[model samples]
Target chain A: MNRKLISDQDLVNLYVSGQESALEELVGRHKSKIYTSIYLLVKDSYLAEDIFQDTFIKVINTLKAGKYNEEGKFLPWVLRIAHNLVIDHFRKEKRTPIVTNTDGFDIFEVLGFVEESIEDKMLREQGHNELRRLIQLLPEEQKEVLIMRHYGDLSFKEIADLTNVSINTALGRMRYALNNLRKMMNQKEYSYRQAM
Target chain B: MVQTFTQNDIIKALYHELPASEMVHLEEQLENDTEIQNNFEDLNVLKLKLDSLVLEPSMSVISSILDYSRSYKK
Candidate 1:
């Protein structure tokens, strides 16, 4: 069976019916978006990994218990699960996300290996890290909208519903997020030119 | 009827979330509107940059999840 031809709902059904690889395909298809969403929210690779695992654990339990009900919306559903897990974590810790590097763990260090030239890898890493920093700087509401729309691939309606805001509010937040990122990127470029 | 488009509408168009009829209007407006064109171009570039920023967890984490799935069969 062509995996691409199968829908997320089908994959969920297959997994529920005892096809193990179906779950693999589903997770593999969404791991990047899911992980990055969590990482951006928590801003720590270790905590992100923990929450990612817990998110899947909840997914597996829910599916195994025959409780999967969000038809044709697996990604959004899983993203919601991960988002809740991140919230639970923060609630337990009793603090908002902090940008800390004292753990000596580089979030990028845990990226899955890929074949690329050293120069290409360095350039890609630099650009991605820079973007990540800018994303981290966004105000919480704007950042959440940006991540859900851009990475989670959630539609504005879905985002509004998930975030308890109106669709226009979600769109407005996204607009702000992109504009803020653009300003920061341009400022960085200007600073680099000045230094050179 | 003349329809006005907001930056938010352009964003919805960027994400393909606009209604088809509104998309047609937005496209038509884009042909004559430099301001909207510039905003769209800037947002599109940033969106592309964002799309390329995919990050993945390590193989070990994936393995752990997979192994748990296998051993904890429903």
Candidate 2:
């Protein structure tokens, strides 16, 4: 079967019908974005991995139980589950996102879809770590909105609904996120220029 | 109208989050406002930097998920 041509909805249908490889194909298709979304919020590689597993577990159970009603919104649905799980985790722990107060958290090793070897991919990814590091500098609200919009591909309205904020509030968080990133970039560029 | 237009408006316009009416209004303002244009350009640059990143889950975690999914049918 050409899994390449299968839509997510089609894959879901297959999984619900007892074709397990379809679910694997579906997970392989989305793991990067979905896992990244979870990691960004939790900021712990171990915890993120656990949550990632749990997200898929919940996905499987939901499908098996015939509760998966999202016809074309599978990614967002899974993402929402992951997002809610992260929120629930923090709520139970009575702690906020670790990056919100921490100075530096280790950037977990990333295995991207590029065809390069692991060493080459790591070397290449190191160049872009600064952006991720600066993104970690954003306030929690701003970072949440930015990640949901950028990585999850959720629109501002969807983000507002998911976060239970007004549309303007979601938009405002993104605005502030970009504004802060610009400020950080300017400062970094200034320091580099001064050193030059 | 241009005088009252703030950074949030420019960000909204840049991200395509602005409504049609506000978008039309902002487009008129952006036509002549160099500062607003500059800010929008900077935000676009930041967005580009962010696009370079792709955070993948750990291989072990993916394996765990696969294993869990396989065992889940019982």
- The interface RMSD values of the models, given in order, are 2.8, 2.8
Model 1, range A1-196, lDDT digits (tens) per residue? 8987899999999999999999889989999999888888998888888999999999999998999889999999999999999989999999988764343134455344478889987887778778888998999999999999898999999999999999999999999999999999999999999999
TM-score of each: 0.93, 0.82
Kindly report which residue stretches of model 2 are placed more than 4 angstroms away from their true locations once superposed.
A100-127, B1-33
lDDT, residue B55, model 2: 69
Q: List the residue pairs that clash in candidate 1.
A: none
Provide the lowest-lDDT 10-residue window in model 1 chain A.
A101-110
List ranges where model 1 is wrong by over 4 Å.
Answer: A100-117
Per-residue C-alpha lDDT of model 2 across residues A1-196, encoded as one tens digit per residue:
7998989999999989888889879988998788778877887777878888899889988998899999999999999999999989999999886553232235454444458888977666665566777888899999999999887878788898998999889888998888788888789989989999
